[model samples]
Target: MNPNPLKILVLFYSQHGSTLNLARQIARGIESVPGCEAVLRTVPKVSAVCEAVESSVPEQGAPYAEADDLKHCAALALGSPTRFGNMAAAMKYFIDGTIPQWLGAELSGKPATVFTSSSSLHGGQESTLLSMMLPLLHHGMIISGIPFSESALGHTQSGGTPYGASHVAGHEGRAALTDEENELAFAQGKRLAELAVKLAA
Candidate 1:
């Protein structure tokens, strides 16, 4: 194994864990690539009231993301639980705070991908994926997505899309990812990792 592996950031926000599940699978795919590592991070929740402040460390799951995380990552995978037809406000708020990276073009030429989880089958997974891509695009990242060649993309009954990998969490919003969803997510990450390694080299 290479002592210094390329770091692929898997950054996301999840309220009920479905998005987190996707992140885990993506990490698996990233690490499956030799000389690459998955660096998982997450953003804190947003509050309408101005007084709210999240602790420097998260209570559970991945560590909260920092500007330095962006600075060092070779590539990125952004995930969120869908809010209406967009990413969660917490994830949006975090992206908004990434002005330094955008200004410096720190993410330029890197391969990036997006993923999401939604409360229902029609709950805007594709739109959510697209929304996340906007910031990455502005940062000059090359967007990578799951293709029809992945097979799961062609036959998935629930929650896989060419735009990105996604999960249908049902109305109550906590369902596990179906087999197809998991497979596609894994493929998405693997594809992105391969691309990122090639680009970084």
Candidate 2:
């Protein structure tokens, strides 16, 4: 085994903290595995009219992600709040800048998974998850999703899905995750970390 812990990047963008909650749970799952560590990262918001500028460091929450983070991670768990059935623009923007990593295959063959938070039960959660997977696929990542073995997927009324872990944040986008949602997110993270270890071996 490698003496240093494998770093699984928990990268996310949360407008109102719902997605961040999911990221935290996923990190817990990653850390549950021996020789694994979770690194949380977020992207800054963008402006529609003009270039949005902010400090290099975020005022709160996880530090803003950089290309180096992607290059060194052993695995990845992406999360975002749904935006009209797709990933939020901020997340996409960060992904768009990873051409160098893509060219060098920095993330190729790594284990990856995704998560999302939506405002409604049917508000495009699955679509958002799928959208996030596109860039990962281009980077040659191996995507993983929750399986039927996860009992929460069969009965989750709020967010769990076979596609990925998710949370229905409700119309106000302030709802807390149900017990099932939390379990599924944690399971997803743990699964990804385990896969990373196995693949590294």
Candidate 3:
């Protein structure tokens, strides 16, 4: 057994806390596995028109993610809210800065997955999940999805999908996760952490 617990990074950008809720559920699943731990980290908001520098530390929620987090994780579970059918710019900005890690192949051979929260039924949750996967693919991580066997994927009314776990935050952006969304998110994280452990062995 690993003397130190394996770290599964839960990195995300949440605007209205909906995405954060999903992250927590994922973390819960990761922790369910013996000798596995979840490291929840978040990216900061960026300016639309110009470059803005956030403080070294975030005011609330998880600590700001550093390149080292990406370098050291046994696996990763990325989450974000939809931004016009794509991941938010803050996440994009953080990912774009990982050129060093990409060049070093820091994430290669690692298992990974994604999740999202959208404001509407058709708010492009799947697309946003795909958007996050594109970079993980480039980094050579093995990405997985919440398969239909999870049962929730076939019947979820809020935001669960085969692409990944998700939540419909409603227009107000404060809606709680439906039962299936929560279940799928937890399942996704558990699957990712288990895969990581097997790969390491």
Candidate 4:
């Protein structure tokens, strides 16, 4: 691998914190791998009002992600709450601004993964994960997903997918992640980090 520790960016957009929880679990998995460091970052919400602007730094939780984070990350784990079978507007808006990186192939050949949260079991978690992958694919990222070998993937009643890690946040979007969801999220993170190390080497 590179002499320095690998920086794995854990980037997400959460409206009610379920997605953030998944991001944290994924980060834990990333850090479990020696020489891999999890760098947590978030994107600001987009406003319908033309003049509304978010502060540079988030009020709490992870700081806002910058283009440089994408440029420098050895790998990425992207998460967002499901928005009508797709990624949230905030995440999409942030990704829409990554044209410069796409042009330069800044994230090309890097390993990446996706995660998401939804309010119900059938709330399109897999589709949300797939939606997030499109932009990363355009950037030439190597997408990674949880495998069926992860036992939780077969048994998770609420949320777990081969596409990636996911959580069923339940009604009101306040449900804590189930044990299976947590395990799968961590596995995805660890798996992504491992791939990053090998690819970088």
Candidate 5:
């Protein structure tokens, strides 16, 4: 790890690969900023039945995100899949559990941005991003978004947005991210990191 890197947490819940892809892109963006580090994490799946269970640790990929990780981060990049114009249940479940962090103002004044992926072009990507911002707002995180100045926003025919970063994964949800989408996601990540470092200074 680079000494004095501004650690930014990239947290999400991705049942499918699209959200995970977006997370990876955002992490790359975060790493582009000098002296900023990206710590990727994910939330555990919630079972339908009360007695159903999952392993304490995930079987693969990044480890489950701890609440303390949110508290200590200098900034955050939140991502989730769209579920009826809302965020995924697993992601919502994780955010709801951060009451302690909110009460303590752990994330207050920190920069935050959100991203989402959906099957349809009109699949409510913007709403999903906005809804995710609600909890972060309660925590007093300053919102960050991609400005139109990024060329990707003006030219993308697929998934790029001003709300943050988004991708149109098609109905099958297996489409590779377009070059434009990837560029915008990286831009968003870099923008957030730059803002965080400036605020810290």
Candidate 6:
């Protein structure tokens, strides 16, 4: 184990609890690594109409992620709910605020992974995941993805992809994460933490 626990910031936006559940599973997987710790954070919602004021801290669940979280993290795992084949606006807004970190190269050379949940199987899980990766790539972080050999990818009738971990919450947007989806999410997190350790060395 490393002397300092590898901290992987699990930042995500969950509107219907599906993405939030996935984030918890991923955090569990990260902490499973011998020298890794999971820092769970969530972003506040934004209004589409005009200025939507959110408290500095959220009313419930993890506080709004801070720019400093990116600075100190050994790795990152980002998650978001689907929004018309893309990540939600709130998550995008949060990422957009990381310009300072990007300019300072604070996240450069870090390992990162993305996860998403959709209302339907074809609701653009892959697209949402790719969209989330773009900002991390601009920050110069290496993108990590789940391998097909995970078996869950091959067996998941609900949601699993080689691109990254995902869940099909169905049109009803349920809370239950299928067994295969949960396994894949955990696997992805574990892989990210392991890579962070190796990179830190």
Tens digit per residue, CA lDDT, model 5, 107-173:
9999999999999999999999999999999999999999999999999998988998998988787
- lDDT per residue for candidate 2 within 1-201, as digits (tens), equals 548999999999998889999999999999999999999999988876435557778888899998889999999999999999999998999899999999999999999999999988999999999989999999999999999999989998899888899999887767578899999999999999999999999
The sequence of per-residue lDDT tens digits that candidate 4 reaches over residues 1-201 is 537899999999988889999999999999999999999999988887622766788788899999899999999999999989999988899999999999999999999999999998899988899989999999999999998999999988888999998998788676588999999999999999999999988
lDDT (10s digit) by residue, model 3, range 1-201: 658999999998898888998999999999999989999999988885434556778877799999899999999999989889999998999899999999999999999999988889999998899889999999999999988889888888888988888999887776578888889999999999999999989
Tell me the deviation in Å of residue 49 in model 4. Answer: 3.6
lDDT of each: 0.90, 0.93, 0.90, 0.92, 0.91, 0.90
For each candidate in turn, the TM-score is 0.96, 0.96, 0.95, 0.96, 0.96, 0.95
Colliding pairs, model 2: none
The candidate maximizing lDDT is: 2
Worst 10 residues of 6 by lDDT: 48-57
Candidate 4: worst-modelled 10 consecutive residues by lDDT: 47-56
lDDT of residue 93 for candidate 6: 89
lDDT digits (tens) for residues 35-133 of candidate 1: 899999998888865326657788777998988899999999999998899999989989998898888989999999999998788988888899899
What's the residue-level lDDT of 22 in candidate 1?
Answer: 95
Model 6, which residues run further than 4 Å from truth? Answer: 1-3, 48-52
Give residue 175's error in model 1 in angstroms: 3.6
For residue 20, what is the lDDT in candidate 2?
94
Give me candidate 3's TM-score against the actual structure: 0.95
TM-score of 4: 0.96
Number of backbone-clashing residue pairs for each candidate, in the order shown:
0, 0, 0, 0, 0, 0
